[model samples]
Target: MRTTPRRLLAAMAALTTALLASACGGGDDGGGRAASGELTMMVPLFGTAPDPKGEVHQAVEKVVGKKLKITWVPNAEYGDKTNVVLASDDIPQVMVVQGKTAAFVQAAQAGAFWELTDKLDRYPNLKAKSEQAELNASINGKVFGIYRVRPLLRSAVLYRKDWLDRLGLKVPETVDELYEVAKAFTEKDPDGNGEKDTYGLIIPKWPTPVFCSASPYNVIETWFGAPNCYGDRGGRLVPAFDTEEFYTANRWLKKMVDEGLVNPDFATLDSGKWNDPFVQGKGGIIIDVNVRATQLYGLLKEQDPDGYGDKLAMGGNLKRSDGQKFSYPFDGYNGFLAVSKQSVRTEAELDEVLKALDRLATKEGQTLLANGIEGRNFKLENGYDVPIDDDDPAVKTINNDVDFAFVQLGTWATIGMGVYESMPTSEAERENLRLRKELAELDLQTAVHNPALPIVSPTYVSRGATLDPIVSDARVKYLAGEITEEQLRAEVKRWYDSGGAQVVAEITDLRAELGAGGN
Candidate 1:
């Protein structure tokens, strides 16, 4: 309803005609230009855009055997810019689409982009794909983009080992133990300054309560046996909040708040400063991605190098009271690189583009993008790449180029993309990497995925913005003790009455049509 095919077709009639004409009116090969050694791409820039003359850029060009013309749009403005580009005639050859927005879905369905579902196999590196990633990125059961890869099981509990040692509390392996540890951390003066100024958890105000990915609350919910976002109930797919496990998890989290174990301002605390409490020794626990442990360790080491060792500890998802482990899983990809049909014009051009991307996924190409020129950006230290300090002006520019440009184009996280290993020089780094790998493998065995991730529900899309807040607001109210359990149930029923029931029915039928089994 929000973005009907009819509406999109009407809105894009002019642009669609232009795109078709361009594709048909190109050169002899039907490609807009000859098979030049140049490729134009658009990507979101999270930091300052790198200088074009930087060494890293040149290194990447040399490795990929192509002159790269990158349009670095600020991340915040990328979505808007993408919308504009989707409606214009001057589209880039390749673009990094952040998500399958309604406009993007319409554009893709209208054949604005090349469908690479069967084409990826021609390139070995690009052909290596994760099943979960493919499922999440598909549009109408077809692949339109080469998805960027991420870890499938990225959740972990981060805690302060120093605080635990001082209080004689062991690392929590179960939800009940975690509660007890949190209580002790809050009430037992774990800081040992003879003052109770610390709390157990450092939960910030989550960005959205609907998606709930990466939220500490979501971690607790999944550990309590709730699904990641949606759960399959008797062949019926429904939102996770509709499950009994979600209710139980909410009650448990509310208990923590009522007992003053978690940060009081968790509802309003900025996520940007979520680590500040841990750094200031005001909190001792953070349930987040495992990679955060390495980052936190680095920050602590920067402040106190000698004492930072063994000061931090990491763990995978905790077990429920029944000793069953369940994990919150990432979608295994960020976004994807989509090639434009108008720009590519022909299958041969598409092949050339895919080949270049395949090369980027190779070991030599990945190393160049990630580590830069060996002697310039890093030095071989005992056969391991040791990054050079960026204090020098030249090194700083290279580092910026790495972060702001080359790294953004990396697909190294894709399974079998290429090997880009670096040895850890410190105990913290070693353990962090070890646990990251170990926990990822362990959690994957028990990860719970959302069945509705790939489903296209018209009702949900149109009414989702209105429908989600019903549960999200109710959950917040229940956590704040402003509403009773009965009130929360009533709110959920209200959601079903409004539009959620229709969403459930549609998703159930669609799942059946797609032959998607239970989670």
Candidate 2:
């Protein structure tokens, strides 16, 4: 059970009672408290790995003095499931959604969630978090949802430093340099096996190239001498797939293949290979998420402590002509929570839920989220959070059995930066601090944040969801020498022809409004 404060827990139990009586008929806009034992909560399964429990959440339940009874929902199938549930108008007392933020917006508009803007102060915990995080609760001026609190980071290239040094190469800081390193790494075995068993790098798109426009590679296309892919010239938000940067990156990738740099089978590179190759000491470089670097370090320390400690290097973005560091686009706003109009029939109920979510957004929440049941799951030593007796077989068993993935740490909202949310164990904290510093020191030549990231729209965010697969397939075939770049170009034209133009228009419009197209 979660260790929510006793008072907050009581309030939740009280809210559940309110949910029972007013849950029917779309809840009233006034204050409400369902009758106890009536409300159910739904949340996307927090852990994608084998572990199923969240200790902080358990603490929340414990604090509430009752089981919230949260059912696990998969993010992949969220849209379909949400639609089905919404169609039936049968929802849990609390629903923490993931995936498809636009749908959330639409749902909230249709009176799906409870509004708490007018009743935020009652839950001091939630209110405090919201204020500290500067979390946005309103969209286009309407209070719609509360964002899931996580910090922001500039993503970068992850490489095996040992391999680079072995190959006598410095970290590549430009597209051209990236190519050169890939080639040399390809030709010269960095693994010391003396066999051509490894590829220079492994940024997979297999069987096709896959990139997130909000990613530095896609959004900062212009820095690579390509058009900026984030928005249309008109300042309207557009999809990255429809942008010229998409084609440019592909072309660059194709050239790498032609030059015997990147693996031709890259398009079909499996996730295991993408991560495992580097972990096992095969591939050298990867454009990875900010979290994975730390996660990889953890995995390495556990599996091959010495090798992990000695082998890896977290690199920054490749620089542009002017030596600007670039970053890929990532969703800035994590999802939000809103009150259902039906529930606010009273201010107190609205206050209750708002308070709960808000509390989950700040430091107290950060501590609980990352560390889990303070004295129980962990011990604080010198202001650092550490798992209890981590070396103990019992501790290991419990950690493996539970409290693994719940440690979603390092959000700008939580610590204002990655430097602050590191592991509390002196050792763990050292690794995190070092890694965080590595990220910070990455000379970002061009801080090209994903252009379309701010706009809340379907056409932009979802455009690549379908086309990315297609492009990936086509690019893979071409890179493996199966298809021509000309063919790839034609396909890109097809993309532009099919809804790409519209996306461009949207981007242009968005940009014009923000006065963002000057560069």
Question: Against the true structure, candidate 1 has what lDDT?
Answer: 0.77
Model 2 residue 162 CA deviation (Å) reads 2.0
lDDT of every model, 2 decimals: 0.77, 0.51
RMSD of 2: 8.1
Q: In candidate 1, which residue ranges exceed 4 Å CA deviation?
A: 1-30, 413-425
Question: How does residue 127 of candidate 2 score in lDDT?
Answer: 46
TM-score of 2: 0.74
